[model samples]
Target: MKPPVLLTRDKFRESVFARDNHLCVLCGAPADDAHHIIERRLFQAPQEKGGYFVDNGASVCEPCHLRCEQTVVSCEEVRDACGIKRIVLPEHLYADQPYTKWGDPILANGQRIRGELFFDESVQKVLKQGKVLDLYTDLIRFPRTYHLPWSPGMNDDDKMMQSLAAFEGEEVVITTKWDGRNTTIYPDGRLHARSPDGRPHHSQAMVKSEAARFSFDIPPGWRVCGEDLYAKHSIAYDNLPSFFLGFQIWNERNECLSWDDTLEWFELLEINPVDVIWRGTFDEKTIRALPLPNPEGWEGYVLRLARSFSYGDYPRAVGKYVRADHNKLGVVHNWRTAKVTPNQLAEKS
Candidate 1:
């Protein structure tokens, strides 16, 4: 067997970082090294055609890279241990590659600009002592608008209120915004948290039971996005009916269904849907005057156009309005803390 060819070029490292958005594909932390799924040595042989290709590479942090080198766990195990959904390489990197598992392209947003790179010289030095080296850059992901707590003096809030006024008469659906970790259930039964890294989120038995009962109802390539209220966040839902409350039913293309369709599917699956606060034209004054949905004071409300619409591969018709005092209770300490038994949390009840 010929020795595997190693990919030591800086450009190759940069490409790997860019593909992973500069975070550890397994843990969602800053990536310090690039790991080869197939050992680089295996490709060194003169007859081997598979050299250092982005198709088999993953941007990983130092700890994850060390775990990979230890050979004590499988790649999937390492990924789960680190809370990763899956190693997603940006589409552009694998455009001509034969691989099928490509990640959503990182689009430019206000939070992070696409194509920007953040290099850490110290991390690079640490990686040099390890088997996998040559990592130097970190790529950032595009940002999406998230629900924010209302602030009195913030000029942005004033601007947002003015902008929302335009939709005052447009029909919209207002769903009670729960204060909990955002989660998603894919058509394939995979559950993940809503984060830049798509970390795996564990649910309680009841939550899993409901998901299993409705798994068959989920169309292929569609996803159920919701809030995991298994644990209390800053807002405690002592009167909550269930641990999970689904809000959106999205299609394979990532476009959300209309309010009616979302409710229909939830009813069919017998899943608890987020409380509908209101259904009418966008009424900023009415929304502002509405009381919190729960005792903790509802986090806010989500406004979704009765009809579905997309903006450059994103859902643009949806927006959220939060109470200024929403975060007054302080931050939720336990966001994505998974159980010791990886699969036990979701065991069939």
Candidate 2:
């Protein structure tokens, strides 16, 4: 007899990878194999149903796939190794099974849908152990406020004055705006960039080393957000005091501490805060006349309110002012070329 067609293979694999952003759910690397979390052979039918379902699959790298297959590690261990809470399964699988791993229950054909589907104690145990640090959940995007030009026909000085209007009566602290890649430090000492595209950042080791240097504690579900200033972006920060500078501290709820509190935490951890430009509220004329923070004309300044604000809500508490004629050098054909080499200065010559 002719072999039964393997119709579900490619489609199921693609769907899993797509859901996982083509990265191994275990290590966040490029996935090459679709792992069956529940071995296909364990299902009742050999050729027909449960084996090909998407709920039982995970997109994994070669090494991780091997580890899953050899039984060297449990499925929960594999998920925790990468901080993945639960692998999302295809919605359709719940139709027949009524329940699947990582999903809520569905009512069978004639039964009334009475109570809500819930994870049993065993399932809850697995889920609690597999807490994943999701990108937005663990690492928050540092908010940026724009510089408002004075008016349609106003001069540069007038524009600067206009931008400072919002902070006229508020206590404001200004700091130099460093050009760098955004990074975050998790409570478990893991470091990651703010990228959603699955592209890896080169500063993981650097961040870890710097984090180790600090003696302070970060409570669970909190993270330290900073600027990874090792490389040159639009403007080269050649005189930067350090490779990384702590700018904000966020709790599990994604609320950012106010400027003063953030600085206090930075001091406690011995982490360098961004260079301060000015403190205290400034009059429009004073703001207009203030000198640029850097003689070389760095990007701009960040104005922050001195007190802490509620988490996850936008605050009119912070703003930035970028130099109109800031350096736009170092444009490259590809971003990989922007990495600062050890001998970048020598090579430039």
Candidate 3:
């Protein structure tokens, strides 16, 4: 809510020390200050707690700090062993892809989901063709700027403001706004199902219902996928209309969808998606030691494994979502649809 004073290098070190238990995130060297590898920036904690505190800041050791400098050093190079991975900035995530029709859309012939998915001709074609891969590559090659979509729920409305307040000065990485019905591009490309809430269940049906009404021009090799929200809520949460919300193209390394690729998919699909609450490499201790403004509705932050090194698909990525629900980030709501309590109205009058 309040702006932070830029921390001096010494101040920055102090803050890092305060937050990091005086140990580097990488090596156990007593931290001199916070070392931000992304820009080689450093910040010290204020004598109090009201100074420049970039959300992206992370505590680093001498070795890890040296690797970030543009100047190449041999021994320091090892610190580069596992640099903090950067997320795609919102602008960078959605620059636009070269339009090219790759092939026919893969439909679900027959699918089975025991533990893994089994695809029929409908699904096989998707797997063999790797249409999802092409679409992914194209979107990643260039994505468009993203805008988040809001709903009636308190999840985004309440938690976003908390992250914003606590990490305002920190480096905030914004990714593309994904648009499309919630669709999952199954690695097999055969088995798919839509979630009841419009999230992609699996790469499955294109339910033609009230919530989902679209033309038939599906991008080749891909399915216009997502959940049957209308169906789920309308019928019995098991059948009926579909209220699709998100989309994902089949990736060769479906199990290992990288952060970069995930960004592009969200862009190309044009669906509303969750965002990076806070980031910039740090271990549990350093993160825990750091002091942040406690706020209501705070979900704290999320830590996702680097995209390149990811080992699972969406809904199952090596991502850890954490946050504190307090008075930190205020709830961001669509004031228009927000309710007016009778007590409040009476007070106003």
Candidate 4:
């Protein structure tokens, strides 16, 4: 057999990007990087192992690049996107692999970013050590509640209030904002707590395992965003319907679902959603005077437009009003270090 040609990393990336038309197949955004479907570090020889070939790469945007690394955007999906068949690895490539170069920096959007490097002793030990990638950087967050008072002289408050005012008299959906970690569950069942790194925290261990139990067949680019209520944070709940309560769902186009649609899908998945506190036309007076559920344990409520909106329109579409002193006085102990406490669940017939 003749020896195949080898390509440098730069040449490999360029060839992969060129093959995909310089566009992210996952989201159709401007492609700035090419990613390996299999771990590049697993390749003992680029020429012999075929690691540097375009068939093993996918052109992606920076955000989608992170998704590829996280496995939320599956290797199969990347292969389908690139119009290639799955790259079957030889057993020798991964079997009995040595921990050679884990936690190495990843190239994305033409820059090196923090890799998926974590301790082996923790719950994150399941993660492989070699060829790490950074956490997703563009994950959406719950918009700040405009009805609640922003600190005085806060630069963005005026603009936020203006956006909120535009929705006056529009129908809105108000849901219980549980005092827990804001978590995102991908179609592949990966859970990420809202944080700078978006890693599944130790406190969220139980919920992460539970979420992974469900086979979510959502569309390739869709995501389920919700609150993981496994551990008590600001308020210790006496009863929790489920450890996870979905609030919003984002489609492949990055557009959020309407409240009615969100509820229906949550039902379809057998996943409980946050309690709907109220649903009616926006009336500041009615909203302010409404009594909160469980005045002692409830965190507060979130107000959002009943209709769907694009990802970028979040600032104008959602808001929340937390109880007084919730941030400072509500949380008395660190949920991570404290002993694992189980919240009571309502009995099902």
TM-score for each of the candidates? 0.51, 0.51, 0.28, 0.56
Residue-by-residue lDDT tens digits, candidate 1, 178-200 = 77767767654556565334444
Question: All candidates' lDDT scores?
Answer: 0.54, 0.55, 0.32, 0.63
Counting clashing residue pairs in each candidate, in order, gives 11, 1, 59, 2
User: Candidate 3 residues 115-173, lDDT tens each?
Assistant: 01112243345334432323222111101111111211233323211111223233323
lDDT agreement of model 2 with the native: 0.55
TM-score of 4: 0.56
With a 3 Å backbone cut-off (N, CA, C), the pairs that clash in candidate 4 are 116-133, 145-320
Candidate 2 C-alpha lDDT tens digits along 1-349: 3432333877778776776788988778899987766544333223434456554567889887766654344555655554444443332222223332322222233221111111234433443444421101233334324353421222233312223444668776778776666777766676666522235656445666777676237778677878776666666644555678887887655567888788888887777888777787655566556787574535666666666654312224555666655534554436664564421222233
Q: Which regions of candidate 2 deviate over 4 angstroms?
A: 1-136, 150-168, 195-198, 311-315, 337-339, 342-349
The regions of model 4 sitting more than 4 angstroms off are 1-147, 150-163, 328-334
| Candidate 2 backbone collisions, by pair | 255-311
Q: Highest TM-score, which number?
A: 4
Compare candidates 2 and 4 on lDDT and give the better one: 4
The C-alpha RMSD of each candidate to the native structure, in angstroms, is 16.5, 17.2, 19.2, 16.4
